[model samples]
Target: MSETPAASVSRRRLLARSGAVGAGIAFSGALTEVFAGTAAARGLGDRGYGPLVPDPNGLLDLPKGFRYRVLSREGDPLRSGEGRVPSNHDGMAAFGGRHGRVHLVRNHENRPTAAIRVPPVEGLTYDPAGAGGCTALTLDADGAVRSERVAIAGTAVNCAGGPTPWGTWLTCEETEDKAGTNGYTKDHGFVFETDPVDPRRTGAVPLTAMGRFQHEAIAVDPRSGAVYETEDAFQRPFGLFYRFLPDRPLGGTGSLRAGGRLQAMRVPGLPDLSSVQEPGARFGGVEWVDVPDPLAAGTPIRLQDFGPRGITHAQKLEGCYWGGRSVYFVSSYARSAEGSAADHFGQIWRYDPAGRWLTLVVVFGPDTGVQLPGESPDNICLAPSGGLMVCEDGGGAQHVYGVTRRGEVYALARNRQNPGTEEEPEWGEFAGVTFSPDGSTMYVNCYTPGTTFAVTGPWAGQPGR
Candidate 1:
């Protein structure tokens, strides 16, 4: 797969407003101030409903017809003899097999500075590179892995990913591969495509065109061949949203692992989009812009209408996915201008290409009163009833919360693992969630104890009351 450079696009010109605005281009401070006065002018109401805010003191909980169970846990031995799960297991994906089993592509978000290194043939261990990466596991659909192999040769810190209709996983490396002597490993940040079934048959192609920034989660539009992505920001500058458009579009055999154009989110005309006032201030009035020359032929459109002043910067935006007609994502860190908690809640936003919309679907802060900053809303899954399942990375304990279509928040399952027990509980303290294809079964992974869960029950569909 390392034969040559990607097939390059010849030129760049004005492409029609292909329905949804391309990416969230950066907005300038000047335009932000201007739009602040009229931020409410644009109609952002048609797309989505609000977020689900719930209480904390409560442990495992949910609304109705919903239930959860543990599938995999830390220290659990594998049939393949690969190894046990590491300290922090952050993200995962599921694949269907012809023989009643499911193939899962999971990530272990371990720290480079700590934790035990895994062995070969079964699991993976990094030498000095970044401390997170992916593993291929074959499960029995009952949520059991028959075998697991660390596919890619030297991948580190693999976070969230988007699945391909052609049947592949695009695992993103979050740590920037900035060598320049100060480099941690070998410039470890780039998207790699892998086969969930055949880990050894995988390919590691750095999407050089996608730019080399810290990548969080990636969601792709199978029909449009457009890939939507999010950045996970900790204490650094606010992470920006992005898009990668391939020349030929998605589908076919080997098309996904190759070339394309990458563009960062910029509210055109608005300078230095990084500098924003508060979390919910609302840049709702800003127009989307394109990045000029970005990574390839797809030059940024550069819209100058939306200003930066009214926009809310996501100090931490981790999870993102393209479900139905909208590109949806979650923000882990939310702050206020006074440095307090801005509404103090983490938020979820939906972006539509055709209708050109970005709606804040849910806000989980104000209700919990747990404004401890970046505690809730880790990875998320879209359930059947227009509901969302959220993982909490908060204080004292970790659990999964169920959000209803009516924006009602409830706890579905709590962590059974506590300080005293040597026996890890049913729900792993760490949370990573993925729903089965039919949406009947919900699979969750614990980040703390490194466990996997499968939740099943009578699930009610959307259009909630």
Candidate 2:
């Protein structure tokens, strides 16, 4: 287990994605209140995680049962052409249409910045394009979005992915350019695979060892198609954390172009352990260090010497999900690597591949005595009862935080979905969270008005299970 190579991928152009997933999906909304639930702001239901409640930035104290509306924001007018949906939305996936319909596929982290550039829309993936990236709505089943596609075009900052069991939507590319020092002609970090429901064949193909850098969430073991990534890695400390394997196996979904094995995440010993509250031995508690050899031909092994011990609660570990078998994600950033700032906070670990281990359950510290009125906690999923939704990019108190499975922490909705006056919730704020295999309905997406929302009520347990 050993690895390192934070970004500068494109060993010479490789990753590729195709299209297929069109049976029908059209759910649009503008609702206000439905079978909602409330917990009176963190009651936590004795940890059964019941008393359910979310969607109450309603008045702004936002925490009780939870309630929210505004299905598709941003310039509005979704049919894919005109007005909005080009914001900064990130990570999504819902597919499963025809009658029991719902197809979402979204991700748009857009960050070229210049008074808000991103505007070249239309089945994106660079080709005379420049827009903010990611977009593919096509909801239905009480959510209504009929059609809207830009699957993955002209990508650069399009982040978050992992959703392909033959279904589509892999869109990642946390942007890291060095085209001669960064004018970024192309060769953006990698990972692109889409097909929301036809958008002229959403073009983009690049998975290249899955290293690159900055790629926020991705968890697709699918029983060994292998992929477990997360890296905001922030500040050039070189930002690392990954694992991608697929020379061909669980049928990882239509050709990424046979290029697998990339690893990083070492904690094995400690170069003198420098405070993450002095953690240097808890390493591999959540075990998954395999950067060795990757077919490079043996010996390589380093993968952070086997993670966890201090300095790993997400230097920016954006978001992740695989569901209870083990993967359970979260952690927006509590700092480490010298700047320091982590006395045990922002956590949710839970990794358990048949006893490999990594359980922290819920420990975002200032003291689970609990005090998160502000920020920290980017993307996490698994709620219906086992509780935990996190997502508070926290600005003017940006929320989406929910915790259960026996550790209550409420504050469900209030992203407002960015019509953008910026006063608050310049965007709905919830980034890269998905549900709807049968969780009834509760789809949220927003990184910058790159919208996608569908929240129905009476949510039963086992979300994302």
Candidate 3:
């Protein structure tokens, strides 16, 4: 399925308002100053709600008048009696439920060696040997957990996934571990669909057509039912951004299992996304190359041959979300010292499916300074107020940032809880960062020690909205 000519025309008009095509396209002033590749963009300044106030509880630090509550912890027993909560909480999505409640499906990026595993549930277990999976949480109107259960079990490294327009979660496994590599099991590294409302509807099946690799996150286009995915491979060959066109478009539940065609993105003249340094640099005539072997029986998709014009690849393609008729994906830093083509802290790209155009919306200059607002944005989501909420996965200190449409950056929350000593403080990276349908509360996760938080404040009164 493809977008209509009217949609393409609409996108062209939007681009005209932002800036014309190519290397000097000005964005909505949402990233101009912050991504100017200057020393000032690397410094910490007041931009969002205000300066973050330190939390006395030694957990999450937030701005004045804003507060967060711990909804789930690593060792807590699930209300559904599905065993203790798993560790290494990662990607997540929120949905509206009965009686104004919120339903959240969260991924557990667990390796086989992790102490606590997502308890295998009947009919929902994919492989008994795999330890990583997903858990669904039901919260009441006041943002308190009412019930929690295992949504999908026996998957490996369930890193991140996207919520479907049909009200389900596409959980992704971030591993290529073979059956015998770890233990008794099956081949991992595939996408699995989970139903937040009913576990029986999930069926614990893997969407093989989505391709097998170091899958990170995905964003689905509601109009065309196209799935855009990201791969978080950190090796020499790196990862390729993928698009999956399902046989069934917008078919409600259990439709992905019917099969689909998978393809990797190819930018005409660019091979590596990190090679481009200028903000607002746009690449036109984008193409998609079919992946011959979606199952990856022999070679990984990124290392496969896509004719003489090879597919484009990036170092760490992390967060992805759909908004304003475009697919926004992130590359969480690259370095020449680390064998990359060039160096940069982070990059946020906007892909217009209608026009087949890719634009660099934000780029964090590689200065190695921890104070930068755009430092290593991992999981991202579009706010109701036309801003971007960024979860930082970088060093020194961790924070959840809010970038206004005018390009101003502000600290919404900071991770004050460190698991290590002061000399070697290890603050876990913030993941998830989603909001309720009513736009009232924001939800996020701490990757290490496994904790979920519900934040509520004067979101309506927040400045720069």
Candidate 4:
């Protein structure tokens, strides 16, 4: 992705202001003040797409000159003449399609009892009893959905996942449902690949070698095709970051089922590193330990094996995206209530493959109620303007936040969809924030009410672009 000159300058200024160019400084209250001040100084709040204009339909709030159109909604009829679109739309990926259009492979984070389910087809169902799966949508140049159909079916809790370099979506099951348990014939916690190009061409196949746990999201290294996964188990045992080194490179005709080695991340000096001191905290010289059993036998892989080994644990490791040769991930709201070392508003970590080090980038402070530009970032994607657009999954009104390369933060869009009274707008978290290949439109999903929207505007002037 290319960056515009203005965005390049903003990012350069951000690095200098945040001291990211320096060895690394602990991001604390003082640093937060500096960041806020820098945002004000650059008039970031007023620039880059300007303020959001409320939607008359009371669905989405976007900046001036920008407008959103609802692409698909829950309970909408499927083009396949099957069941309606499943609820709880989560992670999604955009792929270039025929006739200068885009195809979106979207996950439906439903369970066995979901009101609607992705219609199951022979050979595509992982567990006939499970209901969660993915749906593929083809969008025209105007961001209107042309066709929609089930991409994968019979999975469970199809949460956040990453796209592969070779044009495929890795849909991850976020449940540890065991075989012969809860009416499930097969184990649930696994990753399945779905091709948006032709949903019917590929069957849902579980990549069991990736390790079975409460999987959250994944990012693939385009160079080596190494898959990095994050676990979102939120308990005393928490979750660990994992790396899957495939026996062979994973693009082209590569298959994850061909088998790979799964390993857990371990920071040498920071054993059981749950209490991250502050954002910008750098842990270098990291190591990875082999996971004996990638497939969970009787217990979840992280708890039974990696947890006992003192693998560095994080609280609710959610959305992860690959950009700038690094994997940026989110830890949503680490606090005493969540059994974390410290009470944090949220944390964003960056893992540098070249340096083999993980560094804390942005940290939301302990003030949970504070309505800053962004907090509790969940699904993330790189902006065409060279920054990050983070989806908020926390309390209060949710928004999609834009972070300049220089670290200046601003709200890109806010959820104005309210089923209740206007005094108490029912805010739902945004997920699956992705940009079209040509950067003309951005797509995102509202978790509740289950809606997908296509947003278009003067994206080039946006802070992250």
Highest lDDT: which candidate? 3
User: For candidate 4, which ten residues in a row score worst on lDDT?
Assistant: 22-31
Model 1, 222-334: lDDT tens digits are: 66988887766443345667788877676543575466766555443333322333333333333433444433223211221223432233556678876666577777645
How many clashes (backbone N, Cα, C below 3 Å) per candidate? 54, 63, 2, 4
**Candidate 4 lDDT over residue span 214-280, tens digit each:** 8989999988888999988856678888999988766454477788899988887665444775656
Residue pairs that clash (backbone atoms under 3 angstroms), model 3: 30-407, 48-410
Query: Which whole-number lDDT from 0 to 100 does residue 335 have in model 3?
Result: 58
Indicate the residue-level lDDT of 231 in model 3.
93
- Name the regions of candidate 3 deviating beyond 4 angstroms: 1-46, 366-374
List runs of model 4 lying over 4 Å from the truth.
Answer: 1-46, 251-254, 272-274, 306-309, 366-374, 420-425, 462-465
Best by TM-score: 3
Q: Each model's TM-score, in the order given?
A: 0.71, 0.31, 0.89, 0.86
**On a 0 to 100 scale, what is the lDDT of residue 98 in model 1?**
77
Model 3 earns a TM-score of 0.89
Error (Å) of candidate 4 at residue 65 is 0.4
